[model samples]
Target chain A: MKFRMYLMLPLLLAGLTAQGLEPLSRARLLADRSAVTPGGQETLGLQLVMAPGWHTYADPPGDSGMAPRINFKQPSDLRDASWRFPPPHAFRDAAGVTYGYENVALLLIDARVPPDAPVGGNWTVRADVEWLICRELCRPMFATVELELPVRDREVLFPNWTPLLRRGGWPAARE
Target chain B: MHKAKMWLGIVAVMLLGFGARAEKQAPGFELPDVQGKTYKLADNLGKIVVLEWTNYDCPFVKKFYTAGAMQELQREAVARGVVWLSICSSAPGKQGHFERDEWLRRMQSAKVAVPVLLDPDGKVGRAYGAKTTPHMFVIDAEGRLVYQGGIDDQPSARAQSLEGARNYVREALQALWDGQPVPLAEAKPYGCSVKY
Candidate 1:
């Protein structure tokens, strides 16, 4: 019994890395800041990484393919939220032309924290994301991602995600 | 004098192109069903016809089938004297391409009442420019291609999305029955690309 438990542990831990039901693509949430300031803006993102030779579509997926339908449940403390997707590449095949992202795609969302929100409490944001990944065959996959951050007077930036959030010439968060 | 003649030629060509676009005709085709019965587009000329590109293995296609939405639509359309034809364009060894016997079984299990046409060579699909499974086309009684695009406004593969989805095909069919022009003609089709 002890030997069997040790063998299963690695497999169970591996499952945590695969955030989606389908193994071909993984979806997770990331934020550019550890905390958000009252009346300030912060960027949160749904990061999708696909297996080699597999891809997911962008908005207005060109000739065929459905765009990812991601709905974010904004916390009451947030005033407004909007999303951004990186520029997509055109994938040409025998069927026709499609527009999508290969390898990795980061769909960023900008959330505004209301000025009157109580500080010191955590604000949790949840998103329901759906996408179709395709290689030779296609799979419709969905995942629920979440991020929580403390409401602080001063925003603490996470340098690791700041560069990525700024990539592709997306506009900076408005004050 | 030569320049004037060239200008006349260009104007004539432009007018002809516009005329063709206004009354684009659905391409004629002859395809076999799972039972090896051939169906011809010309044979259904005086009747309204619907062409539905389909692949059962596709999740987008299953979105409708699993919810019984597609079957209900087909039944209602057929009962109202509309001809609904579902075509499969997957090539051999590709997804959704099955031998005749298996194909027949799948249709039976799915309770598909419409004719399931086979286009293994994708010739007919290409002729109609069918890019996706569930790509739809509607032809009027005069064989004019009246509508071409997605079946509904909701493109998600989730079965739950069928609720409150504005079914474009159903609406188009209703308009034709009421002697009204289709409200929308073309939409960005959403589905898995037809396996060719």
Candidate 2:
């Protein structure tokens, strides 16, 4: 029995990874700072990294694909959560054309806290995400990601991927 | 005298049957079906016809087919005396391009009762502004473009989403056949890009 268990362990783990766990894509929550001051705005992001040859769609794919969306439950917790997807590459096929990212994509959200909230409070921000990935086939995946942030009077720099914002801005004209 | 009167009555009935009804003018196209039989839009005048853009490889298409959503709708539409035509605009050497034999086999397995019309050149698809696979269009008995848009309210690719999703095609057809105004004329389609 012990020998059989050991043999199947690797296979079981592989199956989990293949099912929504990703050899294809990983979704992570990021913030500009570990903590934020009351009423101050902090840049938050839902980051996506996909494998080569696979792509998740962009907002207004110019054709039929649905845009990647992120939403917060509370009304004002992530206030002014203006999301702007980086301009996507125009994917052309025999069908027509669509816009999306290959290998990597990031959805930007600006999070703001109400100044009147209690200080030293640790708040868990929950986000619901829905996205479609396609490459010869398509799969719709969704998950709710929670981010814990403590209210403090300090600021920190955004994550390393922020520079990708320069890649090309969204609502951009496509060729 | 009674026999002559009967003959005149039969002639009047025959003339009434040949009377032409007003047509709303859907774009005319003659395409070959899966069995290489020709189907012309003009030939179906005065009858409600449905044009559905489809591609087997498309996941959005799979959503409806795999879950039996689309096939069920097709059956229901046909049973109501509605003419359903499934068109494949996939270009040669592109995705969703299946030979006649393969297409016939797939449709049979899928239990699709409608004719699978081949539109390899995409002329018909482009003419009707077909943007995506699974894009649906319904023409009324008079040939007016009644509804042209998504298949349903829930655009998610998940099959389970269809449980609560409103079937737009069904709604449009129901209203049309009942001689009532179509509630919604068009809704944004959701799916993979239609392979032109």
Candidate 3:
């Protein structure tokens, strides 16, 4: 009886561990270019990284249950900054209509800084992103990302993130 | 000169073939209803048919149904001699999965007049590339897909937005009735992800 109990202990523990580490079904934002120009409206490209066999709800979840939302927090000096979302794909469930991206998606946000605002140093833009990821199951996750931009007058300084950011979902430049 | 003429003829034939293939007819499917009687798409040829992917539990679907927007659309569509099919593609264990009796109850409660098609296996859904509840597809009298996408311009889950949004189904049906081409055939759909 003692040996049998010992043998079952490891099996039971393994099951608990597996349940504890249930694969995370959430969206991870990977930004390729974080910097924007003072007088120019540029697109801040982001890639939604979804777990395999899982999908993140698209913006404006139509009739479905989940929607991915983005909240921006920038310094008061930075004005007229807004986020733009790419077109969403539709998914169906028994409950109704929903929108999301399966595998991965490239999202573009148009942001602008005030032309006459304070310049000459680095400015940090932060975003609080919330989204729901679902596969056979569903899970919600929240993440915060900070983007550093060098402020300048009449000049745009865009960061070079082609290698790492491209992997996430950034599209190649069109001719 | 003869060889050039032959090549041109071949090119024209290829172009015509490509055009025909591009306008391929929508695939036919048979799905069960709340009573388990199968509804076949082929049987409904020579008439306009609207296929609505649905999930009863989804808030977005609730927005339209609860607001009576979907029923209103259905009534108008049927008045114009259109057959409306509301399909549910939820898997057995996923949210929105329902038995025949439950679906009937829900549809009755929602005051839905259209036939509700049950696609538990999701085979029909996959065949149509249906990704969301409320995903709307319009088939013309010839049984070709004329439109596919959201039902309207507003993708919000709130019922209030329905009034302001342009309903695509109405527009497509109107265009087809008037013998005019549909101005918009596809639009990005917004809603919760389909639980496939």
Best by TM-score: 1
Per-residue lDDT of candidate 1, residues A1-175 (tens digit): 9999999998887875564344888788888888888877877788887888999998879778889887766664332445677878999877878888888888877777777768898867887889999998888888887888898888888767755654433336332
- Quote model 2's TM-score: 0.76
> Native-vs-model 2 lDDT?
0.77
lDDT of each: 0.84, 0.77, 0.70
In model 1 chain A, the worst 10-residue window by lDDT is: A166-175
TM-score of each: 0.85, 0.76, 0.57
* CA lDDT, candidate 3, residue B73: 91
Q: A1-175 in candidate 3: lDDT tens per residue?
A: 9999999999998876644455453333433334444565655655666767777765565544456556677643333445455556676655345566776666666655566546776656676665667665455556666667666554543445554344434456432
Per-prediction TM-score, chain B alone: 0.88, 0.86, 0.87
**What are the per-residue Cα lDDT tens digits for candidate 1 across B122-194?**
9989888888989999899999988888898989999988999988889889999999999988776899998
Q: Comparing 1 and 3 by TM-score, which wins? A: 1
lDDT of 2 by residue, B66-112 (tens): 99989889999899888999999988887788988899889888888
Question: Of models 2 and 3, which has the larger TM-score?
Answer: 2
